[model samples]
Each structure stands twice: as structure tokens, then as C-alpha cells.
Target: MPSNVEIKAALRDMRYLTQRAKELSGTDGTVIRQQDTFFKVPAGRLKLRDFQDGTGQLIFYERPDTEGPKLSNYSITPTNDPQGLVKVLTDALGQVGQVKKERRLYMVGQTRVHVDSVEGLGDFMELEVVMEEHQSREEGVTIANQLMLELGVKEEDLIDGAYMDLLLKNQQNAHAP
Candidate 1:
């Protein structure tokens, strides 16, 4: 399994954070529109990510739901038939939820900085420090923390769990009496 040290945070100021990220990374970055369909799984998370192009990926990942940087172990398999796979998976496992977002991707050293505008959830930022085979988890966490500082992300802005979890919570709240 490929692993990374990752953190998700609420974006207080997307303009400032994005500008800082561009200055640090020295690139204009790429914008990707994505829709992720999550399935009910017994363990971990299984989602089919559609890239809005002709390509997509089936991803399974496990990580602790913590407020700070944590290790995520994941596997990804690319597919040219995302729609077909989504149908099969939904039928077999049952669909849980979907998340649609426009993600701006920036590379700062080995870290992937994703500034995202998610539907219904507002804006957020994520830092993924791709871990090398020989690297320790501590090293990845250290790199993630440093990038957090550079990106102007405060500790209070950090969030636990994925966007799917947050969306589901919001849905439940909306229906509650």
C-alpha cells in the first residue's frame, strides 16, 4: 500500500492561501473537477473518483480520523469506465454518498497541496506528504507540519475525517427535528 501523511483544514482565506502556495511552489497549478461516489464498506473507505474527463480511479484508503497529520494507507486502480464501475459497486455494496468539488492542485516539494471548493461544504485545503519507501512516518509528519505553516493554515482550522463524513453529518443534521 502507498501511504502519505495527510491533514485537512478549513480555509479561512482561499485567495491568500492559494497565492502563498503558488509562490512557494512556483507553478500556476492545475484545476480538476471531481465527483466521488462512496460505497458502504465494512472496513476503511471505498470510493470511485470520477475526474470529469474520460478517466477515473477506484480508491480504497484507511486512516485515523484525527485533527492533525495522520498516516493514510491507500490503493488506487485506474479505470476508463468510471460510470460502469460506479453502477456495479453501488448495486453490490450500496451507495452511501457523493462529493463534488473543484480542486486546485499544487506541488510543494513532495507534498500535494489541494485547495478545494466543495459543494455544500464550503472551501478547504488538504496537505498530502507522499511518503517514500525509506522514509519514516515522523519525517512525513514533519514535512506536512512545515508545509502547513508555509500555507498559513492554523491549528484551529484542522478537521477530522473526510469530506464525505462531513457531508453526511450535515445531511443528518438538516433532517433532524
Candidate 2:
């Protein structure tokens, strides 16, 4: 399985981060609209990510739910029939939740900087440090930390778990009596 060092954080200012990312990456970046439907799984996480186009990806990933940069092992398979696949997976594994977001992707060196506006969860940022075959986890962590500094991501702003988890938590809190 391929792996990368990743960090997710709640963002206070999107414009500031966008400007900084453009300055560092020397590109405008790509905007993507995505809807991810998570399924119930035993060990890892499984989500079908629809790109809002005709394309989608079935992704399975495992990572520790930690505040700092952590290693994520994942596999992705592309699909053209996302709706059909979603129905099948929902019938088979049962759907847990879904996350909808508009994401702007920027590349800084080997790191993917994601500035996202989730449907019900507000704004957030994610840093995914793509590791080379010979790279060590320490090296990936070092790179992620450096990028966090450059991107003005504070330690307090760091988040644990995925947007789906956050959305689910918010739902639970809303329904709590």
C-alpha cells in the first residue's frame, strides 16, 4: 500500500491561506467539488468519493486519529458508475455518513495543500506530504511540520480524524438532549 504523512486543521482565514499558497506554488491551483459517502467497515475506512463530474474513486485508507501529522496507508480505484457503486456499497456495508466539500488543491513541493469548505463543518485545511519510496516517516513528518509553519497552521488549529467524523460529531451534538 502507498502511504503519506497527513495533517488536517480548521482554518480561520481562507483568503490568507490562498494567497500564501499561490505565492509559494506559483500556480492558481485547481478547484474540485467532491461528495464522499463513507461505509461501515471493520478495520480501516472506506469511502466512495464522487468528483461531481462523471468520475469517482473508491478509496480505502487506514491512519491513526491524531492531531499532528500521521501516516495514512491507502488504495484508490477509479469508477465511472458512482451512483451504482454507491447503491451497491450502501446495500452491502451500510452507509455511515457523507461529506460534501469544495476543495482548492495546491502543490507545495511534494505536499498537497487542500483548502476546503465543507457543507456543514465550516472551513478547513489539509496537508498531505507525498512520500517517496525511500523516504522515512520522520522525513515526512519533518516536511509536514515545515509546511505547517509556512502555511501559518498553528498547533491548536490541528484536527484529528476526517471531515466525515466531524460532521457526524456535530450531528450527534445537535441531537443530544
Top candidate on lDDT is 1
TM-score of 1: 0.99
Candidate 2's C-alpha runs over 4 A off are: none
lDDT of each: 0.97, 0.94
The residue pairs that clash in candidate 1, if any, are none
Q: TM-score for all predictions?
A: 0.99, 0.99
Predicted structure 2, TM vs. truth? 0.99
* Candidate 2 weakest lDDT stretch, 10 residues: 17-26
Over 73-162, each residue of candidate 2 has an lDDT whose tens digit, in order, gives 999999999889999999999999999999999999999999999999999999999989999999999999998899888999999999
Supply the global lDDT for candidate 1: 0.97
